[model samples]
Target: MTGHHPRQAVVTGSDSGIGAATALLLAAEGYDVGLTCHEDTAGVRATAAAVEERGQRAVVEVFDASRPDAGATVDRLAEQLGGLGVLVNVAGTGHTDRVVDLPYERWRQVLATDLDGPFLCAQRAARIMIAGGHPGRIVNVTSVHEHLPRLGTAAYCSAKAGLGMLTKVLALELAEHGITVNAVAPGEIATPMTGIAEEDAYREERPGNPVGHVGHVNEVASVIGFLVSPRASYVTGASYVVDGGLSLMAAHGHDSATGWRSLS
Candidate 1:
């Protein structure tokens, strides 16, 4: 036991956005955190610093979760943490191409990174947690795109939808072992994934969101932190959407002519 503390957690794609927020918040809650950034070295370092600022141990791993060596990469992180207690799958990519024109390669890229990669990481983390005799938490940071579609993002929508299903499958399979699995699906969070700037212009332009602006990375991270905490022991296979009523726009009269209506 670390003596009145949270355990070690590996937060994937934590260089920025929701991933970075998850790392920082988890650290603040007493979890030693391992952060991975696929490409952005600077964001990786920044997140590591944030973790340390919270008085938590931080290890940074450069990882591409889509590659064949992804399992090896996660294993390296597991070694650094001495074991695993929480796995946050947040590393992902986005797209802005039409379904007809969306390159098959791009679809593969998004699926591999967003869905397949997280599946592999969660599987490996589960093995380690079980062998280490720790009942753990696995929180997949999916997107509101999983249900509510957006224009020119077929690959992203498809992949996130798959991730949602994967979360449920894992919850069912890992339940007997006491490993809880859930998802945080955020909409338009101001992160690299959304490629939206955090400025007043963008905020003022978003007229439909009940919160009246795009969500911040920390908003989603707060939900993720809760899902992994001991307080969430009874929660599993569910997704908490932090979209601030943007999804409601679809239910209301907002014309989804942004090209999202055909996803059915």
Candidate 2:
């Protein structure tokens, strides 16, 4: 990991899973971490402890990413950490429902968190970085759904797809300020979101995933680590897919009745 002088970074939804993993990795890579959790204070505390154990400072806050004031949380975190150099928008949510049966509220919530949240956080972080005269990195944690659709992920797919395009536009706007913007799309990673604990073996033989297994949180975090590094200065307006080739199965359609029958 390379940083010109990234003293601080904010990772939203850092209570557990990929967010926690990224926070710890960034801390080890010499960054003071600003962490946020929607409701998991204990999990955030544990994550903060791990950052401190690595001799890096950690500040934790709580806020709902779907709210309009989401950017205010990042503003406060940056102030608490003294400054901000990296902003990783990992706060996101989703629901499983066919578009015909999906509730309006559910759809709104997904878009709010997955798309609106990242835009606001990136906007605030970029402003802070520019005012402070620091080149910055903005990495949005999207999903493989950004490129491919799932059976019952209408809202999730739409939100991620929108975020993908948003990432490119922001990259173009922020390029003049030396602020690189990008997205990371992961698939079937071992995380609480996927109902798999870190100790569990999420790797199962699957027809979709060519690697025949699930991915680890750290695997996704490592890609995020590199994107935010100085080495990736020219790698803006891109979405890095971190799946085990699961997304490549998009072209190969399976029989709905025989292939599998699970929404997950």
Candidate 3:
């Protein structure tokens, strides 16, 4: 493997939320991480500092995975960091509004970041890891919406679903090369990106998921950590769900979040 001791793991959109949590956890597990903050320098530095605290190396980089220049950006970062081994594609965007009401530009923007960005990042990372002749792991951060449909989020749901299939295809294609590809499809997770705080009117108005609440960033990151770790060497081409069983909970008529446990 390429630089396993200082374990190089590149995580996109790592400035905050699940990306940040994942990097911090991976670093604590002895993986030196390459972190990308779209524009959150302070948050990025904080994440890097946490990685350093774990006695692992951390490199913070400015990266916009959605851009056409993603390949070059990743290449430069990999070269500077010595060798790239693990890739966590956590960069994405979401959408709101019914499909008909959604603007064409907005739809394109969501797909560009959520689907295209991860594809680009993974392709570049795969090339480096394969060329280095290292056993590599690539994990795409998908969503519960990958399989479950959500109203007013047609673009997000569609892109995520496609990303899931892409994960499977990539896994199949890369199996011969010793690179593992998988996805972590999380449900409603508590994060800054979701605009999901108790103070948010939208959240307050729409309080509670089928599980009575949403998941935490760490909850999603932990599974991703395991998937990219050596412990999951045999695991690939899979999309693990961390939705607090909400995906399976048919609580459509059960509107109240407090009624989660009453399903049984």
Best by TM-score: 2
Candidate 1: pairs in clash: none
Kindly list the per-residue Cα lDDT of model 1 for residues 32-132, writing each as its tens digit: 88899988999999999989999988998998877866766677887997778899999998889999998999999989999988999999988887777
Model 1, stretches more than 4 Å misplaced?
1-6, 198-205, 254-264
Cα lDDT listed for each candidate: 0.84, 0.89, 0.83
Q: Total clashes, candidate 1?
A: 0
Best by lDDT: 2
Which pairs of residues collide in candidate 2? none
Candidate 3 lDDT over 1-264, as tens digits, reads 333322788898888889999999988887888888888999899998988988988887888766787767678768877988788999888877898899999988888888988888889988898788867899999999998898999999999999999999999988877889999998877778886752342243323454456677888889998888778888999999988776776655455555545546
Which is superior by TM-score, 2 or 3? 2
Error of 2 at 137 (Å): 0.1
Off by over 4 Å in 2: 1-5, 254-264
Worst 10 residues of 3 by lDDT: 198-207
TM-score of 1: 0.91
